[model samples]
Target: MPRIDRRSFLTSGLAAAAIWRPLGSARAENFRTDPFSLGVGSGSPKADSVVLWTRLILDDASAATSADPFAPVPKQVAGPIDVEWMVAEDEAFSKPVRSGLYRAVPEFAHSLHVEVKGLQPGRWYFYRFRSGNAQSPIGRTRTAPEGVDGFRFAFASCQQYEQGFYSAYGDMAKKDLDLVVHLGDYIYERTYGAGLVRRHGAGVPSMLYEFRDRYALYKSDPELQAAHAAFPWLAAWDDHEVTNNYATDRAPDAPNPAEFLARRRAAYQAWFEHMPVHPDLAAGFDALRIFGHHRFGSLLGLTLLDTRQYRSPQLETSASDDRPERTMLGPAQEEWLARTLGASQAKWNIIAQQTLLSERDTRAGPATGYNLDGWDGYRAARSRLLDAVQISKAANPIVIGGDLHAFYAADVKRDFSDEKAAPIATEFVGGSITSDSPSEASLAAALAENPHLRFASDKHGYAIMRLNDRSAEVDFIGVADRKQRNSPASVFQSFAVSDGIAGVNRL
Candidate 1:
């Protein structure tokens, strides 16, 4: 755990308190008459406490006044100037554990992230947010475990808003999951082109101009909102948040530095504003620290990494010697992860990331190589990551990834060079929410040649993981169809990793 800078936090708290006051009797009366339009959310939970979030959607920003927000005004105003949140031990708000007032700034898209601390561990809690007359639908969340037996959580990635419906989320939300791990590419940056798999509406933003608009468009979706309200989410972003295939300091597939820093700042700001991240970490362009570990008691330790921030350029050259000095998790983050995994007391260590780590020399078959933007281009760094897991000898360090728009389960080997390099880890890769799959007969034939790859599917769906003391079971859930919102879901595949196993086994 990171050391708490009490002095700095206190100083910041004082500064915030100076401008913001607690919601009292008078303020509560002023905010009691609106509809629960936007819904509720929770995230960044510790063993004892968790963050509860809500937003007060206004008819318009200016109508919410000292008087009546709903009164017939010539123009609309931001509703519920102040929002209050409460977390309780019971679903009925019978015993209040933590409560507070948060300013629902229109600048922040009328949203608030309130992190409540110092509660009991391993407990389920119900929370809600209110703005004037309108109360958001109540939400449920859980805290981290103080000890471990075994735990379960689902992992997913590459959700393009235009490409498909969010039926996968709808299904996962209903599952008995401890939490949801969103690896990256939660939303796409591209607008609709002709005959695209998923198509975005007009006015979708790409550059800094469309950042706010893009977020609003996405948040309007009921499925996404419901999923947010359903469970605590741990998320990171890939290139689509800003631009497809964007690297740390470069534009899409471009070598020039360009205005990458400015773009990154904008994208980060938009992400923080829309997500349920704590205020302390909401400094947006000021700081970047998403990589962290989550411990479920002594059972499992989950490390969520940011792959785009510090990675080197994806090499386009075919020669092995021409690979760039690339890094998926950067030097510092990689070191931190290795140390964290090595020191973990948990039974399982899971690395949640944005892309696949398995080696696929696509050249041997009808294909050339894996996407340069994925782990294939960063082979050396990926090798080192696997080596870290191997060296740490952590019990069943399962790796979950999403990016290739396909489901893949593989044995993580120390070296692709040796046929018998001991399997160090198991990887489960989920497909896209609604993206197109590669359609090559040669590639279809290539699957038969790959021995290490246990399973691969180019279908659209999500993965559900159930953890127990003896093993972790995962189900690859397939969507009925990607084009329809009311699509059904079915289990397409299942795999498990035992306590002592280094690779996945089919069920």
Candidate 2:
């Protein structure tokens, strides 16, 4: 038997190709084991293509064993597994549009990333994976529409499995959405807090096995799986996906930079293995380019930003901490964003990012304070992005984010402190899917101090955005209780951002 590292296994190309011979006649008998335990997902949809994903989970010992426990361990499969996939026009898979076979190898956790193409735009399709006799759950996906008038999407974040159930996803799954935007915090790295509805099963993920296992545990949830199967997802990562409040190559509490980078590498690999993202986004261990734009005809343009991986280290902020050198989106990404916003001719330009872009002062005095981890810490960068929006004349620029675990509807003004400066955009910070929130009293106080914030709610839920040529209506949906499974969710508040308006109006 030969041993190979994960990177080599993935990048070897032709070297590993010889090992992927067809499974042949004995395929059904060999693949009797259920390999689709992690479920299936599709993402990065364009007008003609989408990526389909599924990992072959061939029993716990074969897939989960690790010698270092915290390091990337090679998976041991019986052999190169043959995966079959199909895209159809209906749930029954009667009208087949595309079908193909992919070789799932152990180097990449036996996961298949099939980039299917030649599909029509603005159309619904059903997809599924098959390995021998075993079949995966069917997932529904859509391609970006060209020249469409409207589309609906739901944005969610901060789903800490232990804190509560994924009931919000259940409700989201029921909605008719063109896509689902997961802003960040898909999984928490460490476990804390009391009253955990479910445990992460293992300790904080520092190595490849731990990180992979953690993602597997979260993906095993029925509700989360349902949401993934419901629609194609556009995802970005915040701190928790790697570690709490991690910025770029640095982890604040880590004693050494080398150790933190190693952990980050492991987390990035696991995230890539599980997500239905495009293979082009994979940039080895150091980083993954998760920021890109998705166009829905001429109606909407969604630019997903990666704020965590390309930011300066967290800073302690005071009234005078705003500096030009401090950055959230690194120079290249910043340039890319500015160019993208400038070029977008859509009716609405949406910045789907990870943290609250608006300033939120937590202190009791007139002295201004800001969260060191959010955009408030990178004041100059936020200003530059906002200025780009204004200079580009981007139509109906709306920034949607999730991180604070509280819902916030605010006007992104040219200057948050200056009442004279007209608003440049609108921002809606969705509440967490299941994570806990601060006290309502504290949220109220913050809201009162920040008049730019039109509404604030410390609850557990997600947001539904209905976009059209005229306006974008956002319903801030809140779950009754995250601790309870099947907890009902309702619109806690609704706001509309009309075309050409840079402010949110409560409805």
Candidate 3:
């Protein structure tokens, strides 16, 4: 067996041996038993435990094929894989916290996900896995704090695999954040734009048939992999993860309803495979992964939303009447969010979502029509979410987003129509990892037009958010340029969302 010698590889051998138990009593030679594995990971952190994951890449891992190529067709197993996981306080493993074994079965694509529990909160720990005599690489993770004292987190989104470079990830990785919030559009299905302005390798998998292939292509990116290995991530997806501008029962330019639904299920399954997500919560056919809240003790409660799964189709006529029945997060999820926000006891309530919650009607170009695909298209739903924010009066409601490929800060209001509408929340929009740079001239024009927009930038990068008892500062770090393969980044703009005020002022 050969090892890739890359920093990401786990181990050169598998530890502990188990008797061979071939499928249906098949011979051991037929099944895969690759000793040199790809490696391991951890995610979905609770105060006491976290989920550790890994995939046993077989020597003859099946190649992409016509009908669901990534699907693992059963081959006779060489033997049962003895998998062991360990969590320790230090990288040297002097003080081990937990150690255990799990069987690596072919049914799960030879991957292992162990939810390790019984640990102290607000502490950093190192973890890894082992099989037979082989051991995996050491990964660092942290447990959430129990109360609000001081905390720092970075939020990002819109990482198109083939756009240009992952300078954004590199920038975010250096910030030393406690956790990362990926709002949505983690990967784009459609080759996205085209030409130089926007171009990916190929269209992403719309169905399960190509989900694994797409994820493999994405995971292969060194920057993305580095960022993942560097910290624990809380992620969600937007329309591009499955299809462009996709809404429930509707796909961009997609005609057939049944075929589109099948594609959605496939994409969702693939997303689960590649991401550090839990299996129990994966989206199934007709079932949507919508709104959910994560409570970080009494410090912060982060709410992740799925706007694409239940949104009403963007209106063609664009009338106020279209607002009555339309929604971004269907009535049920909307209610859940309201109750969750109103019920939250945390000092900071963060909404991690796909698009700008602020009214972005003043975007630079021709007032040609708003991206009906975004909140601008579902005015009523946006209003509903904002109304909840007002009613709940969350300690400090902050909406973080990443879809438009630009950084923006706006004071969310009860009414976009009322020039004097009371402020309900604060919004911080992040730019993309390697997407097109919206024209600067347009941004300047839009800035001049929209009074609520305190800050806006067309640069490509991510935001570093630090929250303390006093204020939450957001640094709009911008990269040198994404056209090059390796570009360094710097802070272009910075703003702070005051602790008690619903406003963002330049820092």
Off by over 4 Å in 3: 1-40, 59-82, 104-108, 132-134, 194-204, 282-285, 288-290, 363-368
What tens-digit string does per-residue lDDT give for candidate 2 at 299-319? 989999999888988776455
Model 3, position 80: C-alpha lDDT score: 57
Tell me which of candidates 2 and 3 scores higher on lDDT: 2
lDDT of each: 0.72, 0.83, 0.71
User: Compared with the true structure, what per-residue lDDT tens digits does model 1 show for residues 1-507?
Assistant: 111111111224443343334546634423323434546678877897787766554544444453765576433344446666778766656777787777766666666878888888887787776544445666888888787565668777877777778888777777776788888777677753334544456553435536766776666677777677777888888778777787787776444565567767777777776777777776557347888988888787888888888888767664555343568778899999899888987777888888888876655645556667778788778878877887887777888888888888988877764667767788899888766655445345445655667788888888878777888888998898887886898899999888787777898
Question: 500, model 3: CA deviation in Å?
Answer: 1.3
Across 252-364, the per-residue lDDT of candidate 3 in tens digits comes to 66799788888887777666655666656543545756457877778788888888888888777444465467788888888899999889988888988888887766544
Instruction: Give the best candidate by TM-score.
Output: 2
Tell me the alpha-carbon RMSD of every candidate: 7.3, 7.6, 5.5
Off by over 4 Å in 1: 1-36, 61-71, 74-80, 192-199, 203-209, 253-258, 320-324, 364-368, 440-446
